[model samples]
Target: MKPSIVLVGRPNVGKSTLFNRLTRTRDALVADIPGLTRDRHYGHGRLGSKPYLVIDTGGFEPLAKDGIMYQMARQAQQAIDEADVVILVVDGRSGVSALDKEIANRLRHANRPVLVAVNKSEGMQHGLVVADFHELGLGEPVAISAAHGEGVRVLIELALEGYPEPGDGEPAEGDSIRVAIVGRPNVGKSTMINALLGEDRVIAFDQPGTTRDAIDVDFERAGRKYTLVDTAGLRRRGKVFETIEKFSVIKTLQAIEEAQVVILVLDARQEIGDQDAHIAAFIRESGRALVVAVNKWDGLDSYVREQIKGALDNQLTFIDFARFHYVSALQGQGLEPLFHSVDAAYKAATINLSTPQLTRTLIDAVARQAPPRNGLFRPKLRYAHQGGRNPPLIVIHGNALDKIPESYRRYLEHLFREVFKLQGTPLRIQFNVSSNPFADKQAPREKRRERKTTDKAKPASGSPARPRSAGKVAAAVKTKRPSGGR
Candidate 1:
């Protein structure tokens, strides 16, 4: 599971800039104005093979009681509560302010790892700039320039130091496909699990927030093994009450990460809300194979069904890779087809493609529609190979690949998905821009050795060296003697 890193600070301290640097994306807005960010922005980032989720929260004002600042503080507090690691970003050039001290005091009791980052310290003396922040008492302040991407990598390395490396999680038992059922509250997730198993394996109540824990059940269907994980329904953070429910939400998210496939159960009766879309987006970001099940679809009229379908198309367009099944989990109406999709999704996620086939597909894609040129450099795609599975990763080797636009990347992804028949899974493309071999200068020692070798191969001191080319030799022979001397 990817660890969540939350960035917290007072207004305009460059938290969003650091977030953009850490995630290598512009998902977070950066500006000089204070409190430019009001809500939390989330992005996915990877350092080497370790993938992690980052949250850029609004500026923190611990004393704000009633205004918009108060709501922003609340949001930041919630992010800190859910974060595995918290980074307190401070303005180094401005020095440590009173508000920075107050925020530090608040985080001192957070019961999690806290790192103090001194931002906008690009050319300043790191020792002096970090000295003033040590009084904040969080920890040693690490000087960084988020805009220039200085010291960001070291900050993240220190933040994620103790977490287990990627692919180190507990392995699934045997060959069973680990499937997690997740959605908003009262979405019939438990009922879906019960209908699939043909037994009351979990409590399925009509009331919201019935399940408070994620339960795993092992079962067989049609000679295939599956481990069904029924997770507690997720509600909006504002509506979530009690500490246990909060922990349950964390467990639900963890289950989605651990599972090989996720079945997002949407309530057909309710309009597709933000909570539903947020959960779907998380599943897609997690790179898990998805099968969206619109539960409680037993009694909707044709018009209402069409309306629901259109809503899904308009709002949940990000998850178009997943197959949606309008099923009545209570009546076991669409169990067979849903399971078929689940199986197909799982297969597509873990499928392996040969290098030759992947390269051929990439060539065909580029030949069909070449990527647009970026200024003077045109992106050149050479070959492609598989990097990982579960979420199929296609690593393409090329020159000037960094110039590839997002639209062209999506085009290649679509073409690859079509060629490979990869359905119900998010396909990731990693561009490895090959370094120019001739860019490096020859070593002084090598240059000297080559010069000596050329000298040794030349005619000795008293003999003229022969011209190798006929044209050069004729030109040399035809040259007039200087001052009537040969």
Candidate 2:
């Protein structure tokens, strides 16, 4: 395993910027927004050949009494405890503040290898900017600009200075599926993970918000590797005043986007609410496979279970494709079935369909119901094929496809879902209306056909005039070359 280095500092001091620089990826959300990073975000970095784990922590207010500041401080302490080396980032432009001294004192007692990084040190002469931070008394501060990639190498070298070299045996590298476990506070998310791993991998307490950071726990089950991301429970934004939970929300969202499948845990004893529905919708919008797990279902009566199922059905109609399971995280009841559903959902999300099969399905479905007609013209649906996966998408090409109503679209989506047995993942059907180059020529040809039909219908000199049937004239209009030459 690579040596872990933790970045601790106040808000907006460029810790995330430095993390992005070291990791060479914009995985961390970067903006001018303060307190944007409230949880410990882990990333991998390599200074030349030395690979290390970098953790970006929320701003630290060591003596904060209540609310979010205290929670962030505790989270930072946890990261520091696990880290081999700690980099304390301070603003060079703003100089040192009282909070910096308090954090410095705390680190002094931590007894871990500490390095001070004076950020925003670009363009200024060496002694002019770093001289004010001498009173920090940690050590000589490494002047660097995290955003500009200046002095980062020296800063890392100084931080990793006496650390033992990494071993030859690195972590297994391959296609490991990522599954994020998410729910509201105290919903047994952490408990569920601990039960799955059969160990106390994370802190599980009765109090809400016990887990303030998104932690990734990796383990192999039945020869299949999976990374279980145990995330902080999300509360509704109106009820959220703390900065820590806000950061956790961002982390949870990131986890969902990164993971191939998300398990939304729910409390069976409590009433299902709008927040749960909102989260499920977000997962659907992100195109991630979803598995709704009702936790603490060890002793629920059949009536209540049915009630819960009905509520889920009504509230999460958008994600009707998602799989639902009832389980007790504490006792591990129904876990096997939940995981099996997860595997099935992941497979469904990435399932590949052949063109011939998709076309046949569409043709059969359209023949059964027939697309709605617009006035005198009935739209024609040509064919469909798989456009993408991970929330499988099918693109259909046809004439007047843009005119397809939302109701009809849903009908086609439902049909495709049934045809593919696509459960536990949302399926999207897109219509691509092909344009005809000979549309002008088509109008003239139809006019000529109408004239010829009129001429044929007219009596020749003395013969009786024959009447034309509506079906023949309708067929003549229908024969307008199928849209788009195809």
Q: State which candidate has the highest TM-score.
A: 1
RMSD in Å for candidate 1, one decimal?
A: 8.0
Highest lDDT against the true fold, candidate: 1
Q: What is the TM-score of each candidate against the true structure?
A: 0.75, 0.58
* Residues 64-163 of candidate 1: C-alpha lDDT, one tens digit per residue: 9999999889878878888899999999989989999999999988887999999999888899999989899887889999999889899999988978
Which segments of candidate 1 are over 4 A away from where they belong?
A: 168-176, 197-203, 207-227, 231-255, 273-278, 302-318, 359-383, 396-419, 429-486
For 1-486, candidate 2 gives per-residue lDDT tens digits of: 357789998888999999999889998988888788876777767776576778899899888888888878877887777677899999999999998998899899888889999999999886888888889899998899999988999999987776666432212367678899999999999999999999999999998888888899998888888999999888775676565665566567667767888999999998889998878877887778899999999888899999988887888788788888989999989898888998888888888898999999999999999989887788899899998788788999999887778999899988998988988888888899889989889999999999999988777787686678999999999888876795
10 residues in a row with least lDDT, candidate 1: 166-175
Candidate 1 global lDDT = 0.88
**How far is 26's C-alpha from truth in model 2 (Å)?**
26
Clashing pairs in 2: 321-424
